[model samples]
Every structure is written in C-alpha cells, then in structure tokens.
Target: MSNNFKGGRGRRKERGPRTNDQIRIPECRLMSDEEQYGVVSIDKAREIAEELGVDLIEIAPTAKPPVVKLMDYGKFKYEQQKKAAEAKKKQAKVQLKEIQLRPNIEAHDLETKLKKAYKFLENGDKVKFVMQFRGREMAYKDMGKEKFESILAGVCEEASAAIESPIKMMGNRIITIVAPVKKK
Candidate 1:
C-alpha cells in the first residue's frame, strides 16, 4: 500500500500556509496609544509594560502587520518549561545492549549469557546477542542459529526478536537482535 494513502484514497491536496494563533497588530500600533515612531514608540511601550507589570512580547514580525502582547514573560517561560517536563516524563527510553558468545559455549556459558540479557531487559534495555564463529564453527551455521533461538527462548517472557535474524559474512560474526519487553 502507498504510504500516503488516506482511507484508500490518494494523498490529500496541498494546503496554503496555516494561519497562526497569535493575534496580529497593525504596523503603526504605537500611534494609537499615543503616536510617535510608527507603531507604539519603544519608550511608550516600555512605559506600558511597566504600568501593566508585564512584558510587551513581540508576537509577530515581517508581515505587513506586526503584533505585540502584554503578558507575564516569567509566567510564560515557566509554563513552557512545565510542558517540556511533562513531555519528557511521558516518553519511554529504549536502550540497546550486547552480549557476546563463542560457538563452543557450554551450558553454564549460556546460562550466564541469559542472565545478563535478563538483567538488561529488566532495566529497559534491548540485548543483541552475538554468536561469533571461528574456523570450523562457520561450517556448522545451523548450530549457531539453533543456539540463537534457544537463547531467545531462555529470555522468553523478558524479550523478543526486534528484527529478522541478521547473519553477517564478515570474517565470521553471526548477529541477531533481541528487544526488551515493553513495560506495562
């Protein structure tokens, strides 16, 4: 299916630049408050900001009209920080970890490797268990593949394959990825 398909239809038509939420002000904004330099003069604006005890934030520029607002700059900054912190807390951090093994791995070796992977998963990290083959080990590719699957099962409830197993032809490294279980 096409990636841009919308409800089985083609991509939607292009739209013009979206309107901004900021309220626009006339270029000669300062003149209304008490004429001076085009829009409200800088001096008068400063006076207004001081009177209202809020900042005269410039909201828009470059357009035929420019805009400014009277608001608490500190409060605005504080709210923005709050929103950012909330977004950060809502995000989930995923990390990748690696475990190496030799083709002639013994039962204890496998168990140790499995323990390391379990620790990684419990800590929210994915494990990429690599089975490196030496000279004769390459001839028995099935052994490595079988061992990889066995390791996957060993971490059963804690992890799952992130991608299809990848076998590298470089010298003799067989790599596979096992992703951590998503936290509930």
Candidate 2:
C-alpha cells in the first residue's frame, strides 16, 4: 500500500486526466421549439438546467435523437472519481516470495519454513516452495514429494491451489508455486 492519496506540496506531476476510461452516464436531450418533435423545447430544457445551476451538457450529437443532461459536470466528474478510487482500494498487488527447503530438513526447520510461508501468504503475496535434492537424494524423491504434500496441506486455506503441481528433477530441485487467497 502506497501513500497515493497523500496530496500535499512538492508532489510529482500526473499524466493528465484519464477520460479514456470514463463511464458515460445517462443524460437528458434537448431540441428547439420547431424541431422538438415529442421532446421538450430547447428553451424549456435550458431553463431547467439553469434553475438547477448545472451545465446543459450535450451527451449525444450524431444520434437520430440527441441526448443532453441538466447535471453539474463537476459533480458528475467527482462521483466518477470516487467510484474509481473505491475500485482501486479493493485491488491487491500480489508479490512473489520464495522459500527454500531440503528433503532432509528437521522438524524445527520445517516448522520455520511453514511459518514463513504463512506470513507470505497472509501478506497478499505468491509463494514459491523449493525443495533441493542432492546427488543420492534424487533416489529418495518420495520424501521430497511427501514434504511438498504436507506443506501444501498446512497452507491450503491461506493459499489457493496453483494450476500446476510441483516439478521434480534428477539431482536438482522440486518447485511449486502458490498464490495467496483474497483477504476477506
């Protein structure tokens, strides 16, 4: 989380408005007296907008029936900004954190690894669990697989299951990736 809302002096310049992503709201239409058809006259629409002390913003121009609004453009813009801010607040930025282990790890060491994994998962981060295999240890891959299985069970609630399972290799390492669950 960053101090993006910390507006004050000595701030960096923004890249102008992002109107390209604006969500267009519904607006009222105005037409002249002679061309009003089934709609209210332009004078009446203008008077309504003026009474509300808001802009008579023309929203649609190239339609068979053009649209307009008797609303404060500034207020509409502010509401749009508030909605965008609320959406941004709900999004999480997941970071990748790696933990290394060995097949011959002791119970205490495994506990430490599990604790670290839990911390990373609770902090909106993805965890990469790696179990290294030495020369002769490759023959005992079942131990590494068991270790991976146990650890996955330990943090299953904290993290969602990754698409692929751990990849084991000859005299190398067993690697698995897990993504954190969204915080309630």
Candidate 3:
C-alpha cells in the first residue's frame, strides 16, 4: 500500500494576508488606527497585538522590513468580501444579440427585425446584424452592404444607438454591430 498524499493534514491553502504566527519575517513596521510603531521585531509586534486584543496581520510583505497591522482579522476579511460583492453588483453586463437578415428580405420583415434590434439596444445590449447570402445571392453583396448601411443609420437615429463596427463582408455574410449610447 502507498500513501499518495504529499502534504500534512490536507489543510486548505490560505489566501489574502498572513496573520499572527504565519508571518515569518524577523521584523516589520507595525501600525494601528491610533499610532505607528515604526520598525520592530516580529515578536514585539505580536506582543503588542496581543495586548490590544487584535491579530498581527502582515499586509505588505514585500516592503523593506515588511508591514503589519493590528486589527480584527475576521472583520477585515468581512469588509473585503463586502466591497467585492458591492463592486460586482454595480457592474454592467452587456449581452450580444444577433439578428439575421437576407439580401432580398421583404420590407415588412426587415422592419420587424429592426424593431427587435431597437428593443435589444434599449435594454443595454449589443446588436449584430448578420445578412446572409446563399448561392446566387452572393452576386448581390453590394445590395446587402447598402441595406446594412441604411439599417445602421435608421437604428442610430431612432434608437439612440451608435455603430460599434462598420459594415463588413465576411465570406457569404455582411456583418455590422451597433451598441446603445450611454446615458449621461
């Protein structure tokens, strides 16, 4: 029988700042909200942290003598997690919505597609108009390009959108991207 485990006790790898005995440096600049204790032996910093009933947290380990602070480790971790959650909540997520069209699509059908694109832009999403060409339709690429340009103009004017990517031909398709204009 062979033991494949390589490490002791299978403890989870810790993240963020090193606290208390985990800080192995000989000396560090100790600080707290009230005062700075300059550069002191690591043992001395630990003692002061004990006196203040706080943990000696190594915040900046790459500095000259390293930097440690006296604080409640649990509270510090909680605040950091809160800040991250708040930032994620405030971030804007934009989705890409594709609308397919054809070179010789009926006027009514084109209008319907444009309406869907307008709704997507109003909802803070990007619109990709893909005009597909098949067989003999490939010969009419110029007409497809013209239709894309006209669609782009109409969308920009009616939906407060801007062209993110100009119309371009890609193999058998003409593609263009439009995005909603940012408010304020």
Candidate that would win on lDDT:
3
Model 1: per-residue Cα lDDT over 28-81, one tens digit each = 243223333356654566676677666655544454445455566676568768
What's the candidate order when arranged by decreasing lDDT?
A: 3, 2, 1
Lowest-sum lDDT 10-residue window in model 2: 16-25
Better of 1 and 2 by TM-score: 1
Per-model TM values vs. the true structure: 0.61, 0.58, 0.86
Question: Residue by residue across 86-140, what tens digits does model 2's lDDT show?
Answer: 9999987878799998888899988888888888877767888888888888888
Query: How does residue 125 of candidate 3 score in lDDT?
Result: 99
Best by TM-score: 3
Query: Which residue pairs in candidate 1 collide?
Result: 30-39, 30-40
Off-target runs (Cα >4 Å) in candidate 1 are 1-50, 59-68, 157-170
Deviation (Å) of 11 in candidate 2: 30
TM-score of 1: 0.61
lDDT of 2 at 170: 34
lDDT score at residue 112, model 2, on the 0-100 scale:
86
The C-alpha stretches of model 3 lying farther than 4 A from their native spots are: 1-14
Better of 1 and 2 by lDDT: 2
